[model samples]
Target: MTPRPADQRFDVVVVGAGVIGTAIAARLSSTSARVCLLEATDDVAEGASKGNAGITSSYYAAPGTLESDVIATSYRRWDDVCRRLDVPFRRIGAVMAALTSDEADGLPGELANAKACGVAASIVSGDQARRLEPLIGPDCIQGLVLPDEGIIDPMRLCVGFAELAARNGVQVRFDSPVIDIESQDGRVVAVITPQARIETSFVVNAAGLFADQISELAGGTNFKMWPRKGEYWLIDRDWGRTLRHIVFAAPLPDSKGIHVVPTTNGTALLGPSVTDSDRRYDKTTDAEMLAHVTEKTKRLVPSVPMDRAIKAFAAIRPASEKKVRIEVDEVVPNLVHAINRSTGVSSSLGIADRVAELLAGAGLDLTVRTDALDHIPTVRRLLLDPEPETLAALDPRYTQVVCACEDVSAAEIQAALEMAVPARSIDGVRKRTRATAGRCQGSVCMAGVTFMCSLAQNRAPGDVVVTAAGTAGA
Candidate 1:
């Protein structure tokens, strides 16, 4: 791989390209500062941002916590942000059903917390909850209706933020892991990657699972972050219509419990069994855990078809010693630690705004850019409207279906390859274009997708990776 130019400098260097980092970068791009977004993975949203439940939670936090403020603020701005970026967002609402008396007893506190956080929530009887969501099981004794809560396409949200950031002149560098943070006079000077040393006065540690390590590298806080693995089962789109609302069981003290979420892309998702782990990179799902998740989810929403599950995946949430850590380092100036676990996606925009404010407070020049692009060009999905006659007339490649299951056209895949933050691998393309992420799960489309990826990357089919760093051939 070619090394990055040694003399490259930026006003702000953001570590991690997950939702928080990308959102921060996007916000910073509106300013005159030269910002750089660095991601360790080959593509954006490959970390915790890609997995887990994609719900924009509104009432999941305590009253006086940062999570509360951020989640509440993000709930209001989410739809507008998604609209501007042309990302899929739905205010489908969520139901936190209480099946037992112990769970029902917690509803009052949940409602109180939501009220204190300025979030509108209502405690409903089981019958009312069932009326709202007919699929909810008879075991539900009570429920909390968080009408403002919703789901989003996490991949699109991250990509849209990165794309808009790039459009506004933020340099997005993928596969650029911050190996070390060079500091001088108790302030960060530069972030050293293997390929290049990015000279910047300010560094934002949004590194998700590795935030603690990044903090230590910056000679800042001695915080410890353990990975909390949450596994999910993505039900087929056919069952998505059956589940109209995002349903949740009563929360555990440690976990939010398994959820039944209807995603924006017409798919129902279940599980996300929270299990604490020491392994930062362990995203493997356990069969037993998944079975437990199915049982728990089924109790809340009996209609959840476990057999229709198309995919099972896990994400590691960065569980800090504190609930969330969003503060400028006291020891290391110009280094902001923007870390959150479960609510990262929900609170991203709010956190971004706060981080920018912190950066400005720390003497970083943040003059508003006169020419900053507010909106990114929306990529038209041929699969969304596969009008063969009309689409073929517009682009000949549209007629050639690459992924029949997803109705993904050759033109769509080609367009993903040519995006601002172009897809580098088959999974990248899947995230961007939904090419091989259908019912087949790349069984039928993997070859074609890999071929397109290979063609785009100018590599042999054998050399092209289907997803991440390794797993190139098989």
Candidate 2:
């Protein structure tokens, strides 16, 4: 397919339309910066942004690292953003459990580290851990509790940021990968994408796993990104609320170990078993990994029925050199890096805020306006109970549950498409309204979702596609 035309010369060109890029773009939109958010994929959150546990993180991160500072600041700002955008967020709290004596010994240092990073946390015994999260394993010796920890639908968070940014005049271009970045006299001059050439004075590299590639394109090549693969499982909704907080296993040298999370959609999620892979784009679920996650999670929540697990999926974390690498490009002065490996999702908004401040202080013409990031608050697309008052306020089709498994209605799907940056694919709809992302994983709801999407987009069923590459039958 031929690439699209560039809308205009932008003041800032953000590569990668994942959660971080979207957030950065949204924050930039809050300023007078003319920004272009570009993505290789056809939709936002198509990379690391979509598949993680969606924990808002308690900032139990290592102190003195860029990750620590960004997460601490982001956690504070997240509450306001969630409220303003009407993003579903719950501060269900978090617990970092330690089982072995060695693990127990590490708690003080970790707690001390978190405190240094400005995270409000304290150590508690296994009994206290159980009190905080009743489903915790009895064998757990102790845990670090951060009451401010929480969870938010990461996909929705990205969409919300993109929508709000778009409303404020940020040009978002999907299916436009940055293949080249040109610099002149130590300043970034332009970004070359598959679609068009985007001329910009500044560039923010928030490309997640592809950060190294973008850096290379911009004339720096000191870093490399390794894909740390993580696999997860989702159980029924009734099973989700069984836990009151996010649970965690003590960290190891390479990665944060798997922990069970109760998601905002009322489904219990487990796994994210850490491993390494060479491939940058593989999300294949490993059976052995699934089995391992199930066993480990059962140990944490003995009452959880393994048979009830309804879904299994995997995601990759872009390991960014153990530390976050956010700095002005040494080779290209106008280029900035906003790469984080471990807590990218949790720290996305904060990083955006920092990047904005950094750019503004650098003498860029950035004007922060109240109306710049206009987020039109949306009604709950998946209102499980269609009370008369709700139906009266919502689109009429919401009364008909199109996806029985996820309880997504036709009106909900339509509203998702009608948003400022409405979903353009089944995955987008899944993220926005939970249309086909349930226990059946679209097996049951695929046809209905396709039909509804076709109707909403005014296309025949065959004209509607799952992604740009995959088409549907009419």
Candidate 3:
């Protein structure tokens, strides 16, 4: 995947386009330095960012952990950032349920940990928990209520971050995987991607699953990362509307046990049962594990409607003993490694700020630009709007629904393909515009969406795949 020749130069190059990488790129855009964001996939958030519980947790790790500090720092900023970027975010609270006496005994410990992390949490009786969310199982004895735990559209959040970064003069290139690193005198000079050799003084390895390999290529720290897979079932909005808050299982040491988490799209996400594996790109879902997830989540909330299943998705986060890794590479000073095993979407903004600080300490001029944009233009979503007639007048293409289940219009799909980091495939359009991601799962509108994508990309319909172009698997 080596490029032919060196083409362009930049002051900083940010690798990966997950939520963390995009956030870092957006933060770097405020500086005067020339920044470029590179993604190995066909679009942003094709990694763990694409598939997650999507909860903006108020408290995740232990006290004083970098993960906790980052989550705390970014917790209060979501309201302002989401407003500016027009990202969908719901500040719905979460209830950590305990179904037995042994699990209930851990409630006080959870409360203490939340307080130590400066999170707003309190212990509630099962009665109060049931009152808070009537969907709770009758067997629950106690609950830890986190009022700040919220749900967000992680895909839109990442997209908005990259969009604002691109608007502020940060170049973004997709389908460009880093092939090699060129160093001179123990300093990174350029990065070799499949598309071109990008000359840069600074390189940030924010690649999620392949971050360790990126570090190895840059002559950075020696570390290994294994994939920690989590399986989840997407419940339709019909049942999602019945759940008021997130219901969680009592906890496990290495993972948060299966739970029923809500998403910003008015749907609920269940399970996310964790499994350790060496496979980096295994997005396959297991029926047995899925059944386990369903059963566990049912115990968490007995009233949950299991018949309202939309689909199943799996995501694997890069895991290591260290939960958060945001520091300058010991072997390569200019090459910074920014890796967050978990809480990536929740702690993304803080990670970006921390990475910027590291880059500044490394002699990169990070004087904030006065003329940088504070926000990008707003996107009109049919789901959020009440007056479809008014919208159809502004653009008649809005009258043509490309995704009936999601209320996605042809105009929205077109805009997705013509954005700062435009959609290149059918999955790209689905990620941005939710065109093919509805309850129908593109069964009714795949042909129309594919035709539109074909016309926009100037390729035959056969060339377009349902998934992103450079994705690892189905």
The numbered model that scores best in TM-score is 3
lDDT of each: 0.86, 0.81, 0.88
Q: Tens-digit lDDT track for model 3 on 1-474?
A: 443456999999999999999999999999899999999877889998988888898988888988888998999889899988778888899999998899999889889999999888999999999999999989988999999988889999998999999999999998899989988899988899866888998999999889989988888888899999999999888788788898889988877789898777678899887889999978899999999998998898876777789899899988976778999998998998888887999999999999999999999999899999979777788877767678987888988988988889998988988888778778888888888787899889988998988788787777776775332122
Window of ten residues with lowest summed lDDT in model 2: 380-389
The total of clashing pairs for model 2 equals 1
* RMSD, one per candidate, in order: 2.5, 2.7, 2.3
Residue-level lDDT for 199 in candidate 2: 81
Cα deviation of 116, candidate 3, in Å: 1.8
Which residue segments of model 2 deviate by more than 4 Å?
Answer: 1-7, 384-389
Count clashing residue pairs per candidate. Answer: 0, 1, 0
Scored by Cα lDDT, where does model 3 land?
A: 0.88
RMSD versus native structure for model 2: 2.7
Ranking by lDDT: 3, 1, 2
**Every model's TM-score:** 0.95, 0.94, 0.96
Candidate with top lDDT is 3
In model 2, what are the clashing residue pairs, if there are any? 231-272
> What's the residue-level lDDT of 212 in candidate 3?
89
- lDDT for model 2: 0.81
